[model samples]
Target: MTPHATYPATQFRIARPTHQLDAVVAFYTEGLGLPLLYRFEAHAGYRGAMIGLPGVGHHLEFTEHDDGAPCPAPSKDNLLVLYFPGRQELDVISRRLEDHGVRPVAPENPYWEKKGLTFEDPDGWRVVLFEGSFGGGGRST
Candidate 1:
């Protein structure tokens, strides 16, 4: 069966504002292991980055003011759940995050059933590193 492409987005971007852009970038790139797909400085007094693994069809982007002004507080309920292919990969990711001084947190919602480790970003937004998922195909962005 063919899936109808109603949305024009082949690439989906989730954007947020950060008070600590460097730390946030480090968390995604160094800690979470997402590749730094690109970085840009906008004339609108903010710069940002796009991060994701290759060929994922979707990525995360964030912007921050050069003045380091605080944005609105991040919601604890918002989450970015990333799925790795295997348990070993999850282990590796866990270690990387730990090396970056991140401690795992129990998710606000417990439906994950301990299948993954959850870490909060510098902005207090949550990201779940789970073991196994349908990796990036056959869906609209």
Candidate 2:
């Protein structure tokens, strides 16, 4: 199997410091419908949140320092691509996002619109929700 087709890490952690902890957490939990796996309550004056779907091998973590800046402005080019099983699942997620006041947006990349809808999170990060991979187990393209 190709390297991208294979599962390399047992557990993957992507840590990024965010100034908007509450807004960012709400975006993931409400807009994306991700579960809050766990939390660190200002661990050593650093607050953070980890979010991901169940049975996934990795999680997206957001952090902020208590003594750091009060507000965080996410980069424009920061993009996260997520794949859903089918249109049915995508529609359900869309409804969830709408309920949370997140509407579909046109991405800078035209391919995303052709594949699926996109949304800009509270922190200004982009989220592309597209169709799932043919071979499904854990990680996907």
Candidate 3:
């Protein structure tokens, strides 16, 4: 008998601080093209928004900080790696981000054939857009 498989990695969320929730929502929705799934403003001044692809469990949640507590700035040591379905889409999204005033950093062309582009978000977090699997035919951008 074959063994049963269970539980695949489905979703993730990140927290960030911002005084401009509306602008941040616009960036994720209009600029990145992620659909707004939900927004909440609790009584204690807690606020958040969830953005994601339609029909997929994948999502990103941006939470606003209360008590005037400052959220730490993003560092180079921490990065969010995003994988697109293909290289073509990666290029398209990269261009879109640039058009929205978010310039992508230098792409990483690993010898293993994976290519990726990095960029910083409004809160200074590093987001890396990557495509392709490790080891195989490599193409130049």
On TM-score, the candidate that comes out on top is: 1
User: Candidate 1 or 2, higher lDDT?
Assistant: 1
Q: Say which candidate scores most in lDDT.
A: 1
Stretches of candidate 3 above 4 Å error? 1-4, 7-12, 106-114, 133-141
- For residues 1-141, could you state the per-residue lDDT of candidate 2 as single tens digits? 777669666888877777778888998997789999878885889989899879988999989898875555656556788888788888888888899989988788776776588888876778888876635565444
Clashes of 3: 0
* Estimated TM-score for each candidate: 0.84, 0.82, 0.72
What's the lDDT for all of these models? 0.83, 0.81, 0.70
Task: Give lDDT: candidate 1, residue 21.
Answer: 83
Candidate numbers sorted by TM-score from highest down: 1, 2, 3
lDDT of 3 by residue, 52-124 (tens): 8789867787777566547676555466666677989988888888888988765333421247777766766
Error of model 1, residue 70, in angstroms: 4.7
- Model 3 Cα displacement at 131 (Å)? 1.6
Cα RMSD of all models vs. native, in order, equals: 3.8, 3.8, 4.9
Q: How accurate is candidate 2 locally (lDDT)?
A: 0.81
Clash count per candidate: 0, 0, 0
